[model samples]
Structures are given as structure tokens and as C-alpha cells.
Target chain A: MKKRTLISVPVIAALVAGVLFAQDITTWIKKTAGDKPALAVPDFRGAGDAQPLMAVFNATLYQDLSNSGLFEMKPKSTYPLNNPQQQGDIRPQDGKGLALADWASPPVNATHLVFGFATITNGVFAVYGNVDDTRQQTVQAAQLLSNRYLGSPVEADAIRKAHEFANDIIVKFGGSASLLDSHIYFTSSRGGAGGFGTEIWVMDWDGNNQKQLTHLGAQLAHLAISPDGSRLAFTSWPLAGGQPQIGMVNAETGRKIPFYNQQASLNSAATFTPDGMKLFYSSSASGTPQIYTSALDGQGFTRITSTRGNPTEPKVNPKNPNALLFVDGNPKEQIYRMNSEGSGMERVTNGEGEASNPAWHPDGQHFAYAWTRGYQAGEFNVFVADIAEPQKYEQLTHDGRNENPVWAPDGRYLAYMHTPLKSRNAQIYTMRADGKEIKPLTTQGINRYPVWGVK
Target chain B: MTSEFFRNRNLTLTATLLVAALFSGACGKKAPIPPPPAAPTATNTTPSSTNNTGTPGRPTATLTVAPARIERGGSVTLTWMTTNANDVSIDKGIGTVGSSGSQTLRPTDTITYTLTANGTNGSATATATVTIISPPPPVTPAVTRPNPMGTLESRLASDLKDAFFDYDSVNIRDDAHTVLVGNAAALRQIFMDFPNATVNVEGHCDERGSAEYNLGLGDRRASAARDVLVQLGVPEAKMKTISYGKERPQCTEATEACYQQNRRAHVSAGQ
Candidate 1:
């Protein structure tokens, strides 16, 4: 353990040495189906007290890259013996650790390799990571990207460093807006009596550091994180027990921000505009719950829907502010889309069980919702449909009651609530957008209404 | 004159049979315990007797309280006695009691305790009043508006009947029509009593279906009930509707009956 003084300077530094690539890295090539470039991530080397911190960093980095939906990760069992422990170990010598040929050819035929080292100096943590293009023919020319991240010697900061490193890797691969630092806001009934009362909560993208955001000992529903990630809007029943009203709270401070208690008896399912300056919610002020939009200050409140029946759950398209998706009922509660001004209404779901909790993919052309076609009890499953071809939809879930499918900021993953058959508690789960790699994000309490927050 | 004569004779025959039935109840004992002395001729008093048919006599209960009047918060002893009764209960929060027992109670307000005795033959009840001198003011003052009926809103919650819906349908059921009609009449009376008393219609659902969708369904159910009430002459402006979805259920059992009870629009007073 060679100790060094804790560095107080800025953590970010550009690669100062000769770091060059043979190919243009900015313009990402659109790989065809089943043509993902394989990448291998090895456990980083560490010693002494840094070993535990390295474990957290290493696991977080691997999981982040694996869940990126951008590449195929080579299995760890196939890695070569004697992985490089430091920057000096990767020389073109015959017996040196990390021979390029070992990873570039044969058993571990990974086109790209990511290796890193973690060390604690004077109670401060610093991680050095590098991504290499193993097919560059020479070991010296194989280096693609290199960076150093420093943080406090704590598990949370270690996780943060790993996310930062993963984000760098994802950016090099030409992915837009990495989700490594995003937060997910959800409603948890863990604090209520008999699990009936729910409040807002938030956690990291990987479901770490879960925290309760609201102490209101009342039921909350339909949470929506603002586009700017400054405030959270949700449906809350009055503490004295009345109709549900749309409420907003500061995302960082958990302080109540005033939103108008509309003249309606019920106001709920609030979503923020893409600009984060206004909101769209369903209010029954006109005898039927209709889609309405109001400024954050509760001014310019306008009812946007006049359907004689119930129309609720208004979600605005991130790319096209004029377009909105909502649930409307006359025959059954089904997904419907229309202009923001409430014209050109067209039904998006037909025939069978109900559809609800419609969410927009970041691309704006595709949407995901919980639908139960040809109904049965608890038959609701997540389905993704393209607006261009709504009839040819992909069902992502097979069994259980899955609802509230909110897409990750990058549109590559989804978070929802799932209750398996015979299970009484509903838990929050996240999976790839294609419905693969299902992982439960919560297990301690009945959690639902997951809204992915963007920074 | 003949009809009156026959009626009097019928009354006499009934009294004779009642005495005979009471005696028969005691005949089962081998070493027969003598019947108690004749009880006072009060509404809740019945003498222990026997009849030849060997059936239990009607149950009788006599409830009395020591220190019938006391200062606020003072305690009193309430004693009840029952004959030929297997089940005896004292109302006013003193639930079940022995067939005959006494309980010390501290009531904040003036209250009447009723003792009910149930036996094989029939049931009897006796009540005792305990007056509290200078009762303390209520913790929450009665809600007062500009109307004559100060607490009419809370009262209307009980007077107005709730309308139940089907499993997932928002259509007012056939039976709900009768309930809404009665509720509408009650609402009319309350409106005449206090024009400021508004009604709040709440829609609830069974613990099935998605919570978000159920919210909309519940709202639809509430609006449906409000629409019916409006049609029945409940001023639309005087009423509002909200939906609790499956959040606030009246019954938590996982049965159809409980579900039916939960799937309802409860009409109550609004703030």
C-alpha cells in the first residue's frame, strides 16, 4: 500500500498521453441484428482496504455496461490467466500479463477489452480505467480511451466512480445520454398501515440508496418525475380523506411545492411537459375526468378533452409536445392519442381487456403500456407498440400483473410493477426494453408507479 | 259485546300459558331449586317460574347503576341481572358481559347503557341512564356554517345511502335506483334544512384490476351516481365527486360479498 496525499484538485483530466484510434469513433455504425461487438470486463486489481471498494466498483461497472443494451459482454470464465494489474503490465513482451493476442484471438475472442485498477491512498480513493481495441494489431496502438476518477473512500462514491467510468465507455460506443446517473421515483406502501398508505420514494438507477421522499401518511399514486428532475408530481389523497389531488414536491429537498387544488373533486395522473414548465393531468372538474393542462403556477388552466366519458392519465410526448397519449373510456378503458389541444383523437387499443399506464419511448414514435387483451383476471402485461403500426405490437411480459411501464431515459430499459401469480405483494422491477434480463428492484415492500427521472 | 268477551278470554288464556311455561323451565332440576320471590312489576322484570312442557322461560334483564349522577369524568358501577339467559351484553361500548355482572365505567358524556339478554325462548332489554354533571366541552367543536343546521353535514353522511356498483361496471345497478331514490329524498330534506350542506360522492373499487385504471373506474362510478342524483333533483352544484379507487375499501375480505360492498359510491357530506 504505497500511500499518497489526498488530491484536492479537480478529478477530471483529459488523456495527456498519445491516445489514438485507427477508426472514426464518433460516427457509430448501425450494426445489424445479432452483430453486436463483444467486450470483456475483468475484475479490477486492488489491495488492503481498497479491496471491498473495488468489489463495489467492479460489480457496478460490469452491471452498467451489461445493461447498456449496446454490446454482448464476453463471459468472465473465458478470460486469460494473469490479467494486467496496472498500466505497466500491458507490454508486448512474451510473458507479460494481458497479451493482446490472448483476448484478440481464440477462446476469449473479444474485440474490445476494459480493465481497471483501484487503490486507496491516505484514505482517499482513485480508480484508473482504460478501454482497449484489441484488434489494433499492436498492443501499444490498442489503447482507445483512458481516464482516472477520484472520490471519497466510501461505497456510494465508489459506485459513483464506476458509473462515471461506465458512462465514458458508453459514450465511446456512440450511445446518447447514458442512464448511469439517473434516478427512479416510485410509490412505496412500506410505511403505511396494512400497506394501504403509500408515499413517494427515489432510488438510483440500479436500485441503490432507496429513500423516502414524502412523509405524508396518506395514499399516493401515479408518480411523474419532471423533465428537469427538480420536482415530482403525483396523485395524493388529502390527509383528511377526500378526493385525490395532483401534488408536487421539490425532488431534491422533499419540500412541498404548491400546485393548485383544482375545483374538481378528483385530480390525478399528473405528467410534466417536456419543457418542465407545465403539467398535464386528469381532472373531474367538469363532471367527468378529462385531460387538462396547467402551468406550474396553476395559471392558464385549460381543459383539453371533452369526451363525455372518463379520459385520464395524460402523458406528453417528449419529442412532439403537441402530441399526447391518454386513457379514454366509453366501451372500455383503452389507450388513445390526440393533439395537445384535444383534436384528432384516435384509439390506439381495441378489442379485449383494458389498457392503461401508457408511456412514451424517447424516440416518440413508439410507446409502451400495460394491456390485457382477451381478458382474464390479473392478465395485464406490458406491451410496446409503434404508432406507425399499432396492430403489430410486441408483448413483453408473459405472466403476472405488470403495469405502469415507464421507459428509461435512453429508451433501452423499462421499470414497472409486477406481482406474480399467488403473490400478495407487488414489487418494482426493471428490465431491458426488449423484456430480457428481468431484475427486481425492490422486494421489501409493495412498491409501484416507477417514474424514471432525468437530470 | 261477544267479540270483546272472547278477546278478554283470549288474554286470560295467554297469561295462564305464560306462567305454565316459566314453571316448566325449572322442572328439569332433580333437586329442584325453588323459584325466586316475585320480581317487581317492571317492564324488564320476569319472575322465575316453571311450566309442564319443560321449556326455558323468556329471558329477563334488569340493569341498574349506582351513583346515577356524578361529576364529569367520575366512575360508576353498572350492574345487570338476567334470568334464564345464556348471552348478555351491555351496549355503549361495554360489549359482552357475563349472564349477570357489574362493570365500573367512566363515561365523559351523559350516556345510557342498555343490557340485552338473549335466551332460547326470547330476548329482553333494560337500560340505565348515567348523567354527567357539567360535561366537558367536545374536543372538536361542531362544524358551523352560515346555515341553520350546524352539524347537518356529518348527519347527512348517515342519512344518505351509498350506491353499490357491479364488479367493474360503472352503470348504476337496478337496486341502486331504490337506494338513490331514498338518498335523493334525504338530500332534499337536508338541503331544506341547511342549504350550505354539500354532498361528496366517493367512488371505490374492489381489490382487483390495476390501481391506475381502477382510479378512473372509480371516478366514473362516482360521476354516475352524481348524475343519477342530479336527475333525482339533487342540485348538481350542491354535489361533487371523487374516486378513491381500490385504496379505501369498505370490506377487505377476498369474497364476492366483500367485493360487492367495496365497489360502491359512498355519498356523504362534503366540506
Candidate 2:
């Protein structure tokens, strides 16, 4: 009976340990663009046997905050020896535990500190998070946020909870819409070799959860997701050796959506309006592949460009519905912009090397594109420029064949296809708007044409 | 003794359940979960099982067409499966595809589709035929008449010469001019032979530039050829223009000769 009681005592204690409770609270911090608050994020402590999940959660949360581009993260080496695990741990202590002064002082100089702990019991995963203003004089004044997140004991949910917390922090810092939950739709030739093997695939913004979206068994290009994320548009050949046509599919269900087939061939490069009520694409139905607009169901088709050369890749301004941009050339291609009504035409790119794949920045006045910039061997690099100030442009990449630049929802980052000098296949890569901290999101197969989905 | 026995069984059961939960909870993939049955079909089970034996065998492929014979405009499903293969593809505009899957295709003419499977060991190919049966012609005197479309296309292909272009240039060269002049004479004769037939001018490009930009360049090459033929007295209404870009190259080599061969405008009988 004595041995049995010893065993039962631990069993009951373990069962009781699984039961945890915490208060849910939110704190909003309004910040200006110039503040660029310095932040320190300590690894969240794990309370149970949840090392695997805690690793993922901690890494994901750190990555999200770094990618936000709204804060200057302090290095971990300068962090204090004592790290906090809960709201009460953010106390004014000095010897062994976390002290707000350690963060506010010189070497660290963190304007704010994000500390938290996570636990897994039975199958439930919970995260107790806190954000404190290190500049405050008192503990209560320093405490800026306290959040409790609960979800399933899986890596996916762990990632989601981290994203939610990071988004809350980003919004509190006055950042634009977050892209943590959005997806990047692109084309990959992993399905096969050559052009016809290309198919459309989508992945999380951070390059997780890659899934195929189309299996048309044809050469697919120029992927454009609708503003609402419910529909996808691309160029594909309906018949063998026939002209290309615009194809639409239900982005969620993968069901074929009806699109009008024009008489002439060479229909390609489909994009959407800000409202997503209509589509703008390049079609040769009348003559050259010029810009044309049609309703979502392919009705009320109207020609928007009468240029003599092939004008394709029409990207409508996200903020201004009446402003349009496209790529056109007879032999040498260049980026051009015009009013959505086909008036006030202006060339947006100057200098050497062909410019193609123009994508609009969220600010509407600025845009991103790929250009040769006097480079030889057909190597192209990405550049960002103001539509109104064509002479004032910044080249983001110096080497490698970087093209197809698409702006993230936050307008602080750009995701494009990059083919390293040694590699034969292109992979998806993302970097800050200033062309810093370039990170590759895909390593397998030939991926191209990454378009960020609206969240 | 009975209470002791019950407690022991319950504790053992609880331990087993806990272990099971941990194993299942490890599946934390955020990607959409593929249905259970689909996993086996997508992967070749035989090769994977043979992996335990320390050696892999050559890949084998089988391709079949359902309803092998069909009327014109009718579609047929082409199904293919491969084992011990890393890459599988079907020829005739259907490039690389999955190891095991089916695609519905409409063939305007009889075509023999070939599926190729390649593995680290070797490669194998399987062929399936799709025969297009034409509708019976309106009964107007029982005469042994040859297929008009096939004969016309063959004649046009032999008489009409392809015009080549310079690197990244759509301007009609002197050699291309001489070729178009001869093609113009042949087109006049073919139009007279088959009054209802039309010609399709296809523009092609070498594999030196971006696929999207090459598409536009190919369009200009085809249009340039069509304009030259029009100047040589060919009717514009009877000709249609399209661009294949670098997608359908006549040669896959990286040499200059192969690239030159791919950059051309060829006139073919339109469907």
C-alpha cells in the first residue's frame, strides 16, 4: 500500500500540473515611423516536456518580429542573465532575476522587451506572453502588454499563435497590414521539365506550407491572385500549338472558373484591379498583345491600350484604380505606365537593359521591376523606382538573375525569384524594401513569379 | 487483490494511451494534409520497398488511352504510371508530369502519345495511340476519296519554306526575303488546290532570353513573316499568326546552330 501511494501521488500531481490558468489582456502602443524602437526578445521558457513545440514557437515568433521591419532587435549576447517567464517576472529586481534596468541600460539599450513562457499539458499548448517598456520607471508602468494564447499541441498552431502575437505587436507599433497569414502564389517547374511542366503553387509568406494550386499540364505564367484571395488568373494554352488564353480557377477549391475565349490567340499576363471586380490582361484578340480589361466573368471586354508593340504584364495601381502599368516592346522591352483609362501614357524606366515584370508598391507612386541595367549574358536584377520620378531609382540587387518582384502586403518587403550564379533553377526570395537581409524561401525545384496574396 | 489488479490495468492502459497521443501529436505540419489513400498512389511503392534491399532497379512505365478510337473533337483520357522513376513525362506538348496520373486530351488527328520515365538507374518509355475517326462525308456518290486535309497539309509542309531570323531581331533578312518569295508562290498554288484551307504562321524563338520576353519577340517574328508574305500578294484574311516562344524549340541543344534552327517562322496548315 505504501509503494502504491507513492506512485499515485506523482500521477495525481502530474494530472493537476496540466491544469493552467492565465488572464488574457492586450496593450496597444502607438509609435511613429521615426521611433524605430529597439526591441529585445528572449527565448520563451518551456514549462513541460514541450521542447520540440517550444523551439518552433520561439523561432517563429522571433522571425515574425524581425520580418516586421518596424523594430531594431538587440543581439542575444547582450541580454541579461535573468530572463522573465511571466508577467510577475518583469519586476524591479537586480541580483538573480530580470531587472528592467538591464534592458534600459547601455550595452542592451532595448526600448522595449518581449518576454514569455510556453507550456504543453496533455495535448493543449499555451503561451503566456508579455511586452514591457524598459524606459518606464516602475514595473506597472513598464508593463505594456500581457497576452495568453491557447491552441493545439502542433507545430502549425504554434506557428499561428506566434504570428498572432507578432501581428499584435506590429500593429501596436503602427505598421501596415501584416503578411504573416497571407500566402505567396508562384509558378514552379517541379512538376516536370521545360515550359509545359510549369504549374502554379502557393506557400505561406515565410515560405512554409507549400501546396500546388494548379495541374493544367501546360505552360503557365503570370500568376495573379484576386484581391480577395478567392480566385487565381494565369495564361495557358487551351489547345495544342494554339494561342495562349487567360485561365481562371477558384483559388480555394481549384475548380475551373468560366473565362471567355477570344477569337485571336496570344492572350496572356493577367492582373486584377484594386476592387477585383475586373481583370486587366494582354490579349492579341484584335491585333498585337495589348492591354485589355474584362469583368470577372469575362464580360464587357474593353481594350485599354492601342500600342503598336506587344504591351503585356498590366499591373493596376493598388491605391489608385485609374492608374495602370505594363511592359511593352517591339524588340527592346521597357516599363510603361498610363492611366487606367488608357490616357496620360508615360515611360517609367530609362537607361540600358530591358525592363520587365513591373509590380506596384503599396504606396501606388513607387513600383518594383526586373531590369538588365546594362548587364550582359541576359542577367537581370531587381529595382525599385518612383513612377513620377523615373530618374530617381534604386537598384536592389547587384548580381544574379533576380526578377519578378512582388511587394508584400506591408509594403516593407519584396518577394522575387532569384537564380544564383551557380544554380540553373530559380528560387523564391524575400528581402526588406531597402534590399537588406535577403532570405531564400524555397530551395527545391524551379520556382518563379511570386505574387503575394491579400490578407 | 482485485482492487490492486484493476489499478494496475488502468495505469498500463493510461501509459499506452499517452504514448499513442504523443506519436500522433508530432504531426504538426501546417500544410494541408493529403488524404490517406492519395499518399500511396503518388509514390511508387515497389521501388520504396526495394530500397530496403540496398539497390534500386531501372524505372518502368506504362501508358494507356481509354476509348482508343474516338470521333473528331471527342476527348480521350491518357493515363500513365511509372515505377522506380524520379521524373515522368508525356511527349507531344505534354512535358514533364507526375509519376502516376491521367489527363484528358482532345486530338484533332491520330497521335501516338509516348510517356517517358527516368530514374537514377535508367529510362523507359511507353506509347499509346489515339485514333481520330472522321464523320462519314455526306453520301454524294460512293467514291474512294483521300483525306483532303491530310494531303493538303503534307503538300503545304513540303512546298512552304521556313524563314530564319537573326538573334533578337524581327527585321526581315535578305535570306528570309528570298525564302518568303518562294513560299508566296507555293501558297498561291495551295490556296487554289484547297480553296477553303487557311495557313497558320507560327513564330518561334531561341532559348537565350526570358520566357516572357521571348514570347513577345516571337510574336513580332511571326507577324514580320506574315507581313512579308502579304507584300508578296498573299491574302491577309487567309493567314493567322501565333507565337510559340521558346516553349516549342526544334532543337534542345545549347549550340549556336541549334539556337538558329529554333529561331524561325514556319507556315503550317491551320486547323
Give per-residue CA lDDT, model 2, range B111-218, as digits (tens): 988888888877767778888899878788878876764577798778888899998788899999999999999998888888898988999998666666677778
In terms of docking quality, how is candidate 1 classified? acceptable
Encode model 1's per-residue lDDT on A1-455: one tens digit a residue: 11112211221111111122211111111220113568888899776788888888899899888877777899988888778765566766543237766777767888988997888999889899998887887766888888999899899999899999989988788666778778898889877544468888889878888998888787888898888889998888865568888888999877899888678777888889999888888887877777889998566789888885568888888988877888876656788777787766767776467787889888776788888875574368998876555665777788847888998887778899887555557788998776777899898877888999875
Which runs in model 1 stand beyond 4 Å of their true positions? A1-35, A47-49, A86-88, A92-97, A192-196, A374-378, B1-161, B186-198, B207-210, B233-238, B251-259
Q: RMSD in Å for candidate 2, one decimal? A: 36.3
* lDDT tens per residue, model 2, A1-455: 01111223333342244232211111011121224789999888777665678778888888888866678989888887888888776667674338888888878889999999888977788888889998898998888788988998888888899998988888777778878778898888777445456788888888888888777777777788898888999877533556777888888766779999667658777888999999998777776667788998777888877876678888898887977788877456788777776765656677366888888888675688888886863568888776555565678898947988998887778899898666657799998777776999999987887889864
Best candidate, TM-score-wise? 1
Model 2, chain A: how large is the TM-score?
A: 0.87
Query: What RMSD does each model have against the real structure?
Result: 21.6, 36.3
Estimate how well candidate 1 is docked, as a DockQ score. Answer: 0.32
Interface RMSD, every prediction, one decimal place: 2.1, 2.2
